[model samples]
Target chain A: MNIIVCVSQVPDTTTKIAVGADGKTIEKNGVKFILNPYDEYAIEEGLQLREKFGGTVTALTVGNDSSKDILRTALAMGADKAVLISDSGNSDTFGIAHSIAEYAKTVVPDLIILGRQSIDYDSFAMASMVGELLSLPSISMVSSWTINGSSITAERDIEGGKEVIEASLPCVISAQKGLNNPRYPKLPDIMKAKSKPIDAVTGASVPARVTTVSMELPQTQRRGIILNDSEHDITELVRLLHEDAKVI
Target chain B: MKIIVLLEPSGNSIKRSSLESITAARALGATSIHGFMYGGDANSAQIAGEYGLSDIAHTPATEYSSTAAATSLAQFAKSESASAIIVAANAAGKEIAPRVAVKLEAGYIPDCVGLALVNGLIQGTRPVYAGKARIAVSATTAMSVYALRPNVFTARKAENATSVNVRTFTPQLSESDTRVKVTNVIRNEGKLDVLEADIIVSGGRGLKGPENFHLVENLADKLSAAVGASRAVVDAGWRPHGEQVGQTGKTVSPNMYVACGISGAVQHLAGMSSSKVIVAINKDKEAPIFKVADYGIVGDVFDVLPVLSQKIGAVTGK
Candidate 1:
């Protein structure tokens, strides 16, 4: 089996989000970049699947030259090879997915995996778009997966409960959290990753479907108004909710 | 103007979140509201008419899937020259909206709690930083795409609605187009999941053991609320992944969110701070949850939960 996992380099989830001086875009001056956590789950799942099924796992990402560091990390995680879809700068989820899907057409892997969504942009739509662009069976919010001879089964969490679905081979799946406990890279593997081969592919020149005009911080909550000591304050609080807050 | 609202079928009926999107679309001066459904049964068209939609576009999928449905809808949106498209910010919408946005080169906004048209421009108020803050944004593109957050806008029944005009479109797709195949789906047997619940009762590390989650579950049953766990609780495996509410988990905006024995982590607060009424039951008076809570009881949850459940039961007859 040949398994291909798609990943993206995004701002670290722990990075402090700040608005630029123009108050419209995320401030990039001090932001640190890292691999999206969801992609980590995808990579780990791919590696485990490859280990069990005796196949090769290739980790793929689309970004500028700076994103090679994330690919290196994936290589250290037991992937056989890494592919970087290089671009001039960052691309929206659609552009990136389109390029990946076009590349997948040539590779024709048996299974494709990606995170349910990217943590930084959190668009959560790229995997589905890639599935649509390829006309492949797709599943989202997958918690568990098992592969049969020519079919695969996955567990998906819905609003009320879970749904068990089965599809044929050559399917695409976007994994959510808790699918598996992702393993960290060891010192030996990290050193071995230096010798791993990474191929750079130019991304597709698709017109950007959406453009972010500006990104501003959400309105901050005001400091809490402390109530004076008294049981009577409960009534005042309820009254404020009914009148001022209008949430009751 | 013609506004198309993409209605996803939930179970045997239409999701309530789609009605909220229709409400917002109407505010944008939609003369004719078109409801689009994929892999949906015949009742879906009728349900759309009940929601005040005048036209319904039905695209039955051979594969009975969301990807096929989205491809069909994207074609419909382009052919009809739709000025605006509205969808619910649920799993299906989250998957399909961006695909349509990319196909049509439309400006897409996700998790919009409210929408309005100001001076011929559509403005959306969406939550950021989990649910701690709401930011208003305007689309830079010509056609606007919006995904409405669930439970923010109440869905009202529209009386005397006319029958919908239905049309079917065959999706154009290739085998290579369908790369990511869904191999299987597993369902969990339980009560309401956190994302769909109207009220949620959540716990944290304050609970001594995983076995003690029954206490929280008991209160949840009393209020017909879903049970949720903070990251600490989830990491401990007290509950399944579906029950986790935080930055790394599912983002929820319920009507009433009750936190029991939880010390508010910034990540946890990001997921559920947008709840309409926040009630915190914690022994520590300085717990961060109290800062955002509408009502806080400083006491042991073991004692407070029983009394609170009784009070709520007496009022709600549950």
Candidate 2:
């Protein structure tokens, strides 16, 4: 069996996002980047599949120069190979999916795995789109998964409950949290992974069907009103909710 | 331009978020708003029509997979000459919209919180970096598809209800399109899902152990709100994964979010920061949850929870 995990490099959750001078993208100066948190599960799941089923795991990412660092991290996490697919120069989720599909066409791994959605974009679109582009079944936001021969069963989150889905091999699976606890790269493995050369593929560019016009920060809130004040009381809190906030 | 909304039902009626999508369409200057659903009949159409729907397309409800559903919906939208397709940012809508957009080779936008029409072109303000920042995007194609974030826009009802026009649609779905099949949908009995609950009372590790969750649940019972848990508590197995509220957990935008004993981790804040009104109660004064909270009470949960619950019960008479 062969497995491929798609990952993305995003701003660290703690990094404060500032609107760039262009007003369309994040200001990169003094920003820290990390592998998308959810993608860690995807990378770990890939390693687990390889360990259990005896297969090669390949980590793939899309972005510019900053993406290589994440690919190296995947290498440290025991992914056998790493590929960096250029962003295909489009902001369209479809374009991103197609670009990844282009690489999948070459590898044709038995399974394609990814986090449910990247924290940065949060479209939750790529895994399904890749499934469509490749004509493979995709089970999304899966918490638990099992395989028997070629049959795959995935347990995923629905609104009120969980659903069990069945699909054959050669399908797509999007990893949700609780799938597995990812392993931190040991110092030795990290050093070794740093030396491992990563393959770079360029210009998978599908034209973006949608384009960004501008961006703005969410309006800052006034300092929180601490209810520990003498003017604030529990009864007043309830009344404020009813008459002032009107949320009740 | 003809605007279409892909409707997802919350129990018997249209999901509140889908109604917001309809309101989004109307805000885009749509006079004739059409609703598209995969199943149900004239009865469902009645509910949708109440929310500004002039016409409804009822496709034959089959056990179609996500791929089949997306294929059928995209084809239907094309046949009807839909200029814009909007859906709620729910599970099905997020899964289906990109497929439709890719299939139609149209513009795709998801998780849009606000929409505007600039010179007859549709544009939206969507959060990126997990609500850390928001950007405005516009469609460069003839047909654009969007998934609207829930609770961002108030769902306003359209005036002057028109006669409902219901159309039955037979999709050309083949077996090859649905190889992935959902065998069972097992809903937790008698529990209100956090996503659908208007009021949520969440607890954190401050409760110490599973035995003390009763405090949170007891308060929730008084307020008639669903119970939620912070990631720390969920990770410790003190609660089921379903009740977890954070980046890894269900994102909730309830009218009122009461955080008890929760120190707002960024991961947790990513999920609930969009809530309309946030109230945080914690022993630690420096807990990050206080940042986004509309009201903060720096008091010990054990000391304050029962009293607040009792006081609120007295006020609400529940």
Top candidate by lDDT: 2
Candidate 1's C-alpha runs over 4 A off are A194-197, A220-248, B10-12, B44-50, B60-63, B105-107, B118-144, B156-190
lDDT of 2 by residue, A166-229 (tens): 8898999899998999999988999999999888887466677888998887874733777762
List the candidate 2 regions with Cα displacement exceeding 4 Å.
Answer: A88-90, A221-223, A229-232
lDDT of 1 by residue, B46-144 (tens): 766666787777777544455556677888877788878888888778867876776666777787877877677777776654443345676667776
How close is every model to the real structure, measured as TM-score?
0.87, 0.95
DockQ of the candidate models in sequence: 0.30, 0.66
lDDT of 2 by residue, B1-318 (tens): 888888765557767887888888888888567888875444655766666677877776646467777887888888889899998888778778888888888888888878988888888888787677888998888999988878878888878656678887677877657788777888888998898788899999999899998889888887789999999999899998899997778888888899999999878887898888998988888998888888878888887787778777775678
- Tens digits of per-residue lDDT for model 1, A1-248: 89999988777656777866765456778889888888899999999988888889999988877888889899999889899988756455567778899899989988899988776655567776777677677787788878889777777776666666666778888988889888999999999997888898988877554544456655535335444324354445445544665534
Q: How displaced is residue A33 in candidate 1, in Å?
A: 3.1
Worst 10 residues of 1 chain B by lDDT: B177-186
At residue B218, candidate 1 shows an lDDT of 82
At residue B57, what lDDT does model 1 achieve? 75
